[model samples]
Target: MEYDYHCTVCRGHLRIGNKLVFSAKTRDNKYGLIFLSPELGDYTTEHHPDFDIQEGEEYLFYCPICHARLNHTENEKLVRIFMVDEKGAEYEIFFSGIAGEKCTYRMRDKEKEELGPDSEKYRQYFDLPDEYRKYL
Candidate 1:
């Protein structure tokens, strides 16, 4: 089933064809377009050769449409986006911003699901009580 990804700020459609496109910026100020697989847990990515993404390095993500930064304020290492399934169920999707780290989370209300091997890296942040969420 196909799911729609949207920008959390501008609510712009992010999925084009089979990829979710985003504007990415490296720590060195290098910029490029990043195309990511729509499937959760899939780490496949496509980008310009000149815009090298270093593994284990955190990068910034932005909405291609509104230029809104996708980083979650609660966790700089996590990028946030909105998702709607074919049945119109909405979810908050969070994924690792560090290159080569496979971590993705799907959350709706009190229900939460984690995907990818590296998900445990930040799983505790989401699982924490609301009082301690700011610590991450």
Candidate 2:
């Protein structure tokens, strides 16, 4: 399944080839370009060796196009982006920004789909409202 990723702020295309590139700032203030797999549930990442990222460390992500911060308002540990399928239906995509954390959520309307082993770690933030839960 192919999906296109975009920056939520500027709606700029983020998927380049097989990677979604973003500007990242480490907790210690180190900055670098981070390449992440476009595949949902795939946590593989590529970056310069000099741009060291430590596991369990939270990093700030930004859009390379508009340079807008991608951190989700509900949870800073997760980065928000827009994902459009071939049908042109757009959905909100949220993924972990903490190194080595594998959690992702794809949400549309009041529906949601979780992907990754650590997805439950942030499940509470993505849960539908009590009124909507009855329909689920």
Candidate 3:
């Protein structure tokens, strides 16, 4: 089934079949979208490039609207994004990043993780073991 993404903070529609996109950042501070936040602006401009990955690095995804970090946790691999399946079951989409723009869906939990660790404490903050496979 198809899944939909939204900003946990603002409840803003993020992903709905090419409608909106989400923002992502690498440890080195590069930024891109798993999808576009909107159709009007180009986030991957000359001034900014997609994340450059190296051995043993972490990446992050966040809400472009609130600028709130989505994939920040003690466990560096798993990044959670608020998602709702087509059936209307809400879930936390755990995307595990391996390298630059290369990642996999590690898990999909109806039990949500903290979308914001420092500022917005989720019901249960992600603290899983950092032992993800190369690609899901």
Across residues 35-98, which tens digit of lDDT does each residue of candidate 2 receive?
9999999899999999998999999999999999998765688899999999999999999999
- Residue 38, candidate 3: how far off, in angstroms? 15
lDDT of 1 at 74: 83
> Which 10 successive residues of model 2 have the least lDDT summed?
127-136
Model 1, residue 127: distance off in Å is: 0.9
Q: What lDDT tens digits, residue by residue, belong to model 3 across residues 50-69? A: 34444445657678788777
Give stretches of model 1 more than 4 Å off. Answer: none
- Using lDDT as the yardstick, the better of models 1 and 3 is 1
- Reference-based TM-score of each model: 0.97, 0.92, 0.52
Best by lDDT: 1
What lDDT is obtained when candidate 3 is compared to the true structure?
0.50
Sorted on lDDT, best first, the list reads 1, 2, 3
Question: Candidate 2 vs candidate 3: which has greater TM-score?
Answer: 2
> C-alpha displacement of 127 in model 3, angstroms?
11
- Candidate 2 structure, TM-score to reference: 0.92
Most TM-score-accurate candidate: 1
Candidates by TM-score, descending order:
1, 2, 3
Task: Write model 1 residue lDDT over 1-136, tens digit each, in one string.
Answer: 7999999999999999999999999878989999999999899999989888899989999999999999998888999999999999999999999999999999999799999999899988998998899976
